[model samples]
Target: MKNACYCVTEHRAPLQRIIQDTPELTGDQVLLRVTASGVCHSDLHFWEGRYDIGDGQDMSLSDRGVTLPLTMGHEIAGEVVALGPDASGIDIGAPYLVYPWLGCGDCAVCDRDEENLCPNQARSLGIFTPGGYAEYVVVPRAKYCLPLGDLDPARAAPLACSGVTTYSALGKFRDAIRTDPVVIMGAGGLGHMALRMVRALSGKGAVFVDLDPAKRQAVLDAGALAAIDGAAPDAADQIRAATGGGARLVLDLVGAESTITLGLAAGLKGVRVVVVGMFGGQIKLPTVYFPMRAMTLEGSYVGNLKELRALLDLVRSGALDIAPVTRRPLHDANAALMDLRDGKVVGRVVLTPDPA
Candidate 1:
């Protein structure tokens, strides 16, 4: 079989189409007929070739070992087409969400089921290797494949990245989430999914913050406690008033200068702030604030394989509500990415090989 891929031949350039013959799989590998793939904001950074790292500095993907002609879709769902001789416990023709955060299996982190935290080699699909911006994908191992069951492939695709990322971050402070309403920044894809996740997993609710009135309204419609405009002069004041003093936990999904500043300002004493977005920018805070307010700041990357399975279980049980998803054909990936980068997408956009 020849696989047709939309590859990043050059940074900031449209993905060029390439067809290559699918070769025989090595032991433990499996061939997947790509069913659905999500267009994520991180793809924008990969396409642009660098992530802004505050001031005038940037981190280049090329310097980090990412090469051109890359197929960059990590949030993927596909049907198993074939398996290697040693690949076990997977059924052919069954749809599953592929866990893309891979590492060398011998690492300590990988041994602990925390491959996403692997400090050594990161063979993460779509980033470091071939991904699902095509009709087919090659998963290095069956362990990376989780059964989608009755979940819609298009809707389930984002679960591999956005869903699991938010879920893992929320799980970190589930106690605080259960006791008090958390402040959620940004009402885009991650924020929307987090709203549903908080509802399903915690007793308390979330007060969402976004600059866009439409996004604020969307979260409000999704049963958020309150949706505040981040651009409002009284935004931090509004958040403080809404949370009664201040929020105990803040999920900074925007992860930029403004959102970080707002989270810090709106936080109560001993507040835990988790930054999950890749919208890179730096912030400055007085050193005294850390000790005086006892605030905690943490950065969360995409989740691990165990978290992915747990999230999928919640999704399969109907406990978790699926976020609104915009479906586009696989061939329209470039346009879909441009739309996402331009803030034109209301919710997550999933690319399906067959858009019928």
Candidate 2:
């Protein structure tokens, strides 16, 4: 079989169509026939080639070892079409979600199954390696393929990224989430998924912060106790009011300057703040505030395999309402990306493979 991949040949330019003969896989690999891939916000940064790091500075993906001609879709769901000689466990033709945040398997973090936090090397699909924006993908190992069971491929695809990312972040402050409504920043895909996971795991809800009136309304409709305009000057006050004095836990799904400041401001003393978004922008930290407030600030990358399993269990149980999804054809990848970049997408947008 030949692989037809949409390659990012240049920054901000449409992806170049590249066709290549599918090569024989190594002993540990599994070949997946791409079923659906979710367009993620981080793809914008990759497409643009750099991330804003505040005060006129930007970080280049190339500097970080990402090359051109890359296929960039990490949130993937597919069917196992082939497997390597040594690969085992996963059945061919069974649907599965690909876990993209990979690390060198021998690392201490990877040994603990928190490969997403691996600092030495990142072999994450669609970022450091070729990903799912194509007809097929060769997952490095069968272990990365989590079975979808009864879940729809379009919905399950996002669980690989948005679902697991938010789920891991919430697990960090599960105690606080169980006691009080955590304050969540942003109501986009991550925020929406976070809301559903919060209700599922903690039996509580959240107060959403977003500048978009429509997003705020959508989160409210999704069962957020309250929604505050992030652009409002009194946004922190509003969050504090909604959470009673101050929120015990704050999940900043938009990790830009404005949301970071607002999330921190809306927290009580001893509050734990988890920043999970890659929206990218530096923040000015108050040195004294850490001690004065006894704050805990943690950065959560996308989740690990074990967490993905737990999340899948939750999703498969049908207890939580999955985030609303908009389906688009695979060839419309650029248009779907543009919509996400323009903040026009209310929920997640998944691209289904073209008819065979």
Candidate 3:
């Protein structure tokens, strides 16, 4: 059997099409016929070869152990086509959302179901291993496959990343999301997913901030309490006014220095700020304010397997509205990545297998 894939043969270069033998499965492994794969902003960093870490320096993915000729779509949903001898419990014809954040299964973190946080070695798919930008993908474990039920494959694909990332971040705010208007930064894919998850979780609603007028307007039309221009001189004041005071729960989906500064400026004392975006940059703030304001600032990575399952349950119950999705053929993977890089995508973009 043959597997057709689009791979990153070099940084900042177009993905090259490669055909190879389909991987053989073993030790509870499962083989999927790639049904849908969502293009993510993180893929841009991998393609560009580094992350903007503020000042004049950047963090290279190569330094962090990423190698080339990599397949780079982590938000994947696919149909079961074959399985190893030990693989069981999931049917061959069923569709599932693949959990891409993996780790050394013997570690303490993995034992606690926090594989995404494993400090030993990051084995995340689309990063450390082959991923779903192809006609066939090999999952190392059947446990990573979560049933999609009746959800659309393209829409369900992002639940593995954007959906679960926002859900887990919102989970950190706890009941604060219900008591106050949450301040959300960046109205891109993650921002829109955060907004929908807030409403689905029964939060008080969100006040969005973005530099793009179109994105700001898009979220406003989607039911944000207010959409303020993040570049506006009085942007903080606008957020404060929208929240009827300062925001108590602020979710920064864009981790740039300016966005973090805006979020801090717009937050009330004792506020909790969760930074989830990898846009990358650094910020400087007075140390005294940490105690004086009783403020909290932390970062959240993509969520774990348990959270993904919970998020899927929420979607299955019809409580969480799936983010808007744009579909393209698998052959357009390079175009999809470029569009996302240029800030042209309104929501998630999923790549489907090219028709035979």
Candidate 4:
């Protein structure tokens, strides 16, 4: 039993190919034959030595001690074939969503359903261990896999991460805050999908801000009420003005010092700003305005299984239209990552392990 895999050996170098024994499933693990995995921009962040987010096993450099040389693919989907009897309630041969986060289950965070925050936690099938880049992945806990019936597995993969992150960010403000108008910064992969989600979940105000003319138009085509140029000299004032004094909610999907600065610049007095991007930047705040405006700033990471389920329902019901996907062979993972990094592809690029 042999398996093929794409392994990232060094920073910026192309992933090398390797053959290994087919993974053995633990009694508590569910083994899935890899079908589709989305090449995410975040994966590039790791490859380029930009973002140091992982469980500290493979990284040459560690953030709080998480390392790299890891098999990359966080957002993944496939069919389950084997599981330990201890892994009850999950049937073999069922198509399921893989929740990548693997946590210390008995912790306070896990008990509260915030496993991403678990002190001893790490995401599997990507960040923690050999991920979906290979033909097979061993999932330690069956509880994390969500059922995907009749949905295109390729498109569903990105929903596991990009979709879940953006949707989770929007979910909080979907019901409570001002829905009259909502603003999304960055019209890239996640931003485009967010435009669709906002329209589906929160129907009041839909405004998109992006530096790319093509992306700006795409957001508008996806049903944004207004697509303002993010690079406009007075973009902040323009956004603030367009939203009728201010947008109550602004999702900064491209977080960086500049965009975070722009977010503050474009935000209303009482807006809720959620920063979800990993673009290596910081926000500078004015000490005086923090208390006076009653504005809120929150950071959201990839969502948990509960949020993934809600997002899947939206996708399953056809309320959210995922961007069309582009396919490539497993060996072409480098090109897929490069395309995503260079802004050459739309939607997501999904890699098929067995392209026959």
**Clash counts for the predictions, in order:** 0, 0, 0, 8
Model 2 stretches with alpha carbons more than 4 Å out: none
> Which of 2 and 3 is the better model by TM-score?
3
Model 3 C-alpha lDDT versus the unseen true structure: 0.89
Q: Candidate 1 regions off by >4 Å?
A: 354-356
Tens digits of per-residue lDDT for model 2, 1-356: 99888879998998777887766988879999999999988898899999877778888999988888899999999999889999999999999999999988678998888888888888899998899888899998888999888789997888888888888999999676788888998887678778878888864679998988998999899789999998888988999999988988989888888888888888889988899877767788979999999999899988899999998998778776676688998888888898888879867899898766
lDDT of 4: 0.76
Kindly give the stretch of ten consecutive residues in candidate 1 with the minimal lDDT sum: 347-356
Residue 156's lDDT within candidate 4 is 86
Q: Pick by TM-score: which candidate is best?
A: 3
Poorly placed runs, candidate 4 (over 4 Å): 52-61, 64-68
| CA lDDT of each prediction against the hidden true structure | 0.89, 0.87, 0.89, 0.76
lDDT ranking, best first: 3, 1, 2, 4
Per-candidate TM-score against the hidden true structure: 0.95, 0.94, 0.96, 0.91
Q: Identify the superior model by TM-score, candidate 1 or candidate 3.
A: 3
lDDT of 1 by residue, 111-153 (tens): 8889999988888999999999999999998999999887899
Write the candidate numbers in order of decreasing TM-score.
3, 1, 2, 4
Q: Hey, what RMSD does candidate 4 come out at? A: 3.4
Candidate 3 ranges beyond 4 A from true positions: none
Whole-model lDDT, model 1: 0.89
